[model samples]
Target: MEVDYVVVGGGSAGCVLAARLSEDPAVQVALLEAGPPDASVLIHCPAGLALLAKNGQANWGFETVPQPGLGGRRGYQPRGKVLGGSSSVNAMIYARGHHADYDAWAAEGNAGWSWDEVLPYFRKAEHNERGADAWHGSGGPLNVMDLRSPHRFGPIFVQAGMQAGFRENRDFNGAEQEGVGLFQVTHRNGERCSAAKAYLTPHLARPNLHVVTGAHATRILFDGRRAVGVAYRHERTIQSVKARREVLLSAGALLSPQLLMLSGVGPAAHLQEHGIPVLHDLPGVGRNLHDHIDVVQVVEAPHLTDLFGLSPRGIANALKGIVEWRRHRSGLLTTNFAEAGGFIKSDPAEPLPDLQLHFVIGKLMDHGRQTVWGHGYSCHVCLLRPRSRGSLLLASKDPLAPPRIDPNFLADADDLRRLVRGFRVMRDILAQPVLAAFRGREQAASAAAVSDEQVERFIRGHADTIYHPVGSCRMGSGPLDVVDAQLRVHGMQGLRVVDASIMPSIVGGNTNAPVIMIGEKAADLVKAAREPVHATREAVAA
Candidate 1:
């Protein structure tokens, strides 16, 4: 099969790219996804994230190599394997990070990505239910709205933050990003509006747009240094799709770089080690890996049946919530689990908020993979900008094998120091009088820690990724950069990576929104690149 563009990976960015690029009837776009369709009830229902977190269906249950920073523990990394990508399985929190984050990307020699410039793309991708503002947009593909039936405990958490002397911020994607408040979500009504639902679903009928699910991309089919298409496995058969224009790799951070290396486009020596002939010899295809290293404070509040849990009462309430949600799309089933959260500074003197908080109305032990009994609440504190970096390398030359992921989390001493400060602030907020009635004894590794030293020990024991992994295929003009400002892979032609992997640095907040914006901007860049050819064709015809 051949098309104008082959979008390899029907994730957040690929969905948007396929949708936008196919908008012009003249263009043909094909989107390939490794997982099955996003038809599971677990993908649409906000509360189903808990179940999805534990079950590996539609999720790439990848694990990092043992990290010395976390006492040699192998951290779990869950990325979406289905359509809409991580946005389908994520908490749905709509955060854009701080404005300065984009500016930092531009400062790193990435032109046209400054905060002021990229804000337009962010606004362009959003369809905020609160109506259009200077900071947000309306009538766009992606829907952003407040939870239809937020857990009652959400306000209590926000109030507790305020009581703990933090300011209240109703919008994290607004004029400022440093305060505590209830988070808006990427939902339409009470259902999750994943990228596929927002962008790809609406345009599936477009004859020019083709979506192939359960097709795992194996490698790029290149002619010389120019990527021509993608070869993928479908139903135990290796099938290849040709691209007339370009091949857009949006397989996400972990797999995008892995695919590049598998296709022989990474560091020359590394490719040679795997016995693959080097294509472009780009040294930065898989370097610069990082993630938001997170630590959670779980409290056992068994009496609060309103919160999610496994107790009889909690189960009964959840059953009733299912009925209410199915009937009217409202109830506890609408909760994103992470009902309320905010961005704030670990130190008052910090220029911008260095830490982010996610107040979950349930015990999120081991990324919710571990089942804990009774009702409880938990708050997660993650160091937004870590100095530590890691890499993504091939475990084997085979594309079917998982990449060796090493986040090198907390390798920088300052990262741990900042997390320690953030932990104290979160602990204080959870202790506020507003939350005292619902608060219970601290659970897990945190319960035994008291002093700062003990807190650091607890963090090292329990901290893991909050599922935001970026970089690896960063965008810039430096020696180690993989993509240029247009997101085109350096030293290669007719190929671009449009995913979190292209992030020069991980943003300060949840990365879903920013990645969607990257898709929105990348679509324009791809179209802009095609205009000249179209113009010449028109001139010849005239």
Candidate 2:
């Protein structure tokens, strides 16, 4: 099949690209997804994320190479493989990170990405339930709303923060990002409004747009230095689709770089080692990978039956929640586990909040993969901006194999020190009188760790990613940069990467919202570039 644009990956950015580009009915767009469609009931219901987290269905479930910083433990990296990407299986928290994050991008020689410039695109993509404001928008595709069934413990968590001397912030994406409060989610009437739901689903019927699921893109087909099309696998058969104008790669932070390397567009030496012919000698294709290193503090509270767990009471409550949700789209089923969270600085002297906290109404260990039987709650404290960096390399020449991921967690001594301070601060909040009623016996490992040395050991033993990875295909003008200010791959034509991968640095909050905003702005950039050519064509015809 052939189209004006062939978008590889029907994730958050790809969905946005397909929808926005197809707006001009004159243009034809095709979106290819490696996983199944987002048709599962588990995908639409907000609480279904927990079940999705435990299983590999619709999840890449990628594991990182054992890191020396974490005492040689392999970290779990779960990315959404289905449509809407990770946004379909995430906590649904809507955050844009600190304003300085975008400014940092602009400072790195990437024009049109500063906070002041990108804020409009953010507003253009949002349809907040609270309506328009100086910082938010209304009547947009992506819906952002307050949780309909927020857990009672959410307020308690905030009160504990206040008691611990932190102010309460009702909106994290507002004028400031500090303080604690319940998170606004990407929901509409209690149901998940994933990127696919907002940007792609409603546009699927457009005659100019085509969406194909279960298509694993193996490589980008290039003609000379320009991306001409995409070659993928569908139903055990190899298939190729041509792109008349451009091939937009929105395969995400990890896969986007992997695909580039697989197509022989990455580090030439690495590609040659895997017996692949080099097409482009971009050394930065898979470099500069980093993520938020997080550690959780668990407290067992069997008395709190409302908390999610494996207990009989918890199971019964879940069943009841399902019924209530199916009937009215309300009740416990609407809960996004990390319902309440905040951004704070480990030390008051820090210019910005360097730490982010997520209060889960359940025992979450190992990204909720390991089962801990009990009714309890957990708090996650992550270093928002780690100095540590890592890289992604091809494991083999085969495109089907997973890439070798090394996050190099805590490679910097300062990252560990800040985490220690963040842990102590979280422990203090949990100890506040307001939470004394809900708090229970601290997890044995955490309770035993009192001294700074003990805390450092604990972090090395248990710290992992909070699931935000970026910079693999960063946008800048540096020798190590992959894409430019327009998001086009450096030294490559008819290609652009519109996802978290382009972020020069990890943001200080959840990445989903920022990625969606990238999609919004990228769509405009793509269209603006095409306008001049279209004008030239019209003039020639006249």
Candidate 3:
């Protein structure tokens, strides 16, 4: 079927763009999702995020090539494949990152994308609990609310941060972003308010907006230099969908660049190796890959209650609460489990916070690698802005085959040093009197016997990704850049990338909120581009 816009991937950014672009009523939009619908009960429940990891239903379950830098361990990279993408299964922490992040984009020749220009888009997408203002918005589709029933250990983590001399921030998305506080979650009542739920679901009734589930886009249908449409797979047959105006690819950081590469839009030599005819020869399509890596330091608590024990009686309470959510729109399910976090600058001279912290009530050992009983207060420190950079390249031309992800973590000595510093800070947080009150003892293998060298070795053994990946299709003004200042593909027409992949650099915090804002702003760009063409036609008619 022919549509005005064919959006590939019904993920976080695609959902937003599909919803906003179709709002005009004159535009026909087709949103293709590779996975099933996000109607699962676990999706809405904030505490259920852990279960979604590595699950075949909603997660993509992609892994990286063994990293030689990190003792040759192949990292498990789980991205959401369902309707809302990773945002559907993510921790639900509403972090917009540092203002300097956007400004850095502008400094790198991405005009009109400075912090000032992008701030409005961020504010536009958010319906904050604190109402509308210069930094936040209200009455938006995505609802941002404070945690309803914060975990018992949440406050202890906050107090520990206070003891460490950090201030308590009521809102991380407001004012300055450098304080410990409870995260604002993407929830409406007790259900998860993913981008798909907030942006796309309400607009599904529109005749112009067609949401195709279980349709996996294989490649871009290009006419010489312009992306004309997409060829996707649904059921057992391959189907082609034509875009009358434009084909927008929002397949996210990993898949978007992979699609571009598979469609002959990436590095020339690489494409030749795969026996695919080169279309654009854009070297930067998959050159710059980055992610936030974190090391989890877990400790034990005797009286602490964990999510695993929430059974029969606990589930009855949860059902009653769900009923309340259905009736009164308030309950315990409204909160994200990892309720509070913070951004701390390790050094005083730093312009912004370099270390990001997440405190969870459950025992987290190496991204759920180990199961330690009893409730525990776990605090982790992530080097928010890393100096290290990695790359993603095609292993083959096959669309279903996962790309080669080399997130060269700890390749740089500085990154290792910074992470060590971050671990030390976490140790300080754990040692504090308030947090110590709940702590029975250290539970980690490395923590049992302490040494700076052992801690470094443990970090190398235990550090895993924080699930925030960006910069595969970097946006800039350079020969290696995949997309330009206006987010247009470097050499293709009627095609643009508007996802986390376009980020020239990774943000200082979680990437979901920034990705949503990218969708919001890209919609404006699409409309603005259409305006000029419409004006020219009207002028000629007049």
Candidate 4:
């Protein structure tokens, strides 16, 4: 098969790219996904996400090598495997990150990526329920709505934050990020508005667009220095397709770099070690990996609300919840566990808030992988920025082999210091009078202790990633930079990486919204700069 453009990965960014690129009825586009179509209720119902990590149906449940910083324990990295990608399985909170984040990208010599320049793209992709404002948008493909029914404790968490001396702001994605409030979600009529549902599904029937699920792209076919096609495995058969214009890599941070390295575009020595001859000896293909390392503090709560301990009565309550949700669609089933959260400064001296908090109305331990028999609200206190760096390297020459992921969590001393302080602040907020009615003993004994040395030790043993991984294929002019400001892979032709991997730094909050914005901008980049292609150059190898 052949097309004008071949897009790898029908993920968050890929969905946007395929939809927007195919908008030009004159062009043809193909989107390849390794997983089956997203048709399960586990992906649509907001509460069904409670079973996400265990439900292997739509996730690439990749585990990392044991990190020394995390007490030699391997960390879990669950990425979306189905259509719409992580957006379909995530908490549904819509966060674009701080303005300073994008400003820093521009300051790092990446043009056309400043907050001012990127805000327009953000607006272009959003259909915010709040209507059009200077900061928000309408009439876009993606839907952003206020949660129809947040858990009862969502407001209590905010009030407790206020009582603990934090400001209560309505919008975290507003002028300033430091405040506690109810989070706005990316949902429509209580169902998840995944990228596929918003973008790809609407355009799938267009004659110019083609979507192939369960097709795994194994390599990008390069004629010398220019990419011309791709080889993929579909239904246990190896097939090749040539691109007339370009091959856009949107395989995400983990797999995008993996695919590049597989195609011999990564570190030359590393590729040689795996017995793969080098194509492009880019030193930065799989470096600068980092994430929001966080510690979850679960506090057993008093029986003052629906979020409480496990018992016979709790079982009855859950049954009633099911009936209520199925009938009205206005019950707890519509709740995204992380219904309330905000940003804060661990130290007042810092210019901006570096600490972000997520209040889950259930006992969440180890990304909800650990089952503790009880209902207790959890607080996730993660440092917004960390100074540690990690790497991704191919384990072998096989295209299906897992890549080695070393996030090197908490390798920096400053990260641990800030997290310890944030933990104390979290305890303070929970102790506030507004939450006294529900506040119970800390699940982790002495979780409120402030001894610097002890806190540091506790953080070292307790902290894990909050799942926001980026900078593995960062954008910059440095020697290790992988892509340019326009998201074109440096030194590579007829190819671009339009995904979270191109992020120079991880955004301050969730990655779903920012990735969608990247896709929107990337489509414009291609549409504006696209030129007539020479048909004779088309080449496909299987």
- TM per candidate comes to 0.97, 0.97, 0.94, 0.97
- For model 2, what is the error of residue 472's alpha carbon versus the real structure, in angstroms, after optimal superposition? 0.5
Candidate 3 regions off by >4 Å? Answer: 54-56, 306-332, 369-372, 531-542
lDDT of 3 at 177: 94
| Cα lDDT tens digits for candidate 3, 1-542 | 77888899898899999999999888889999999999997787776675565245598888888987578998878888999998898889899999898888999889988888988888888888778887899988898887776666677788888899889988787779998888888987667899999998888899999999999888888777777778888997788777777778898888999999888898899999999899888888887798998887777664544433234544565667677766765655555657877898777677899999998766776565454445555777898887778989888888878889888888888888888878888888778899776546787575753767777788888787998889998998898898887788988888999899999999999999999999999999988887211111211111
lDDT of 2 by residue, 1-542 (tens): 77888899989999999999999999989999999999988899998998898776789999999999999999999999999999899999999999999999899888999999999999999999998999999999999999998899999999999999999999999999999998999999889999999999898889999899999999888777777788899999888887778889999999999999998899999999999999999999989999999999999899898899988999999999999999999999999999998999999999999999999999998888777887889999999999999999999988899999998999999999999999999999999998887658898989999999999999999999999999999898999999999999999888899899999999999999999999999999999888221111211111
**Candidate with better TM-score, 3 vs 4:** 4
Error of 4 at 144 (Å): 0.9
Worst lDDT run of 10 residues, candidate 1, spans 533-542
Better of 2 and 4 by lDDT: 2
Runs off by more than 4 Å, candidate 2: 531-542
On the 0 to 100 scale, the lDDT of residue 92 in model 3 is 90
Preferred candidate (TM-score higher): 1 or 3: 1
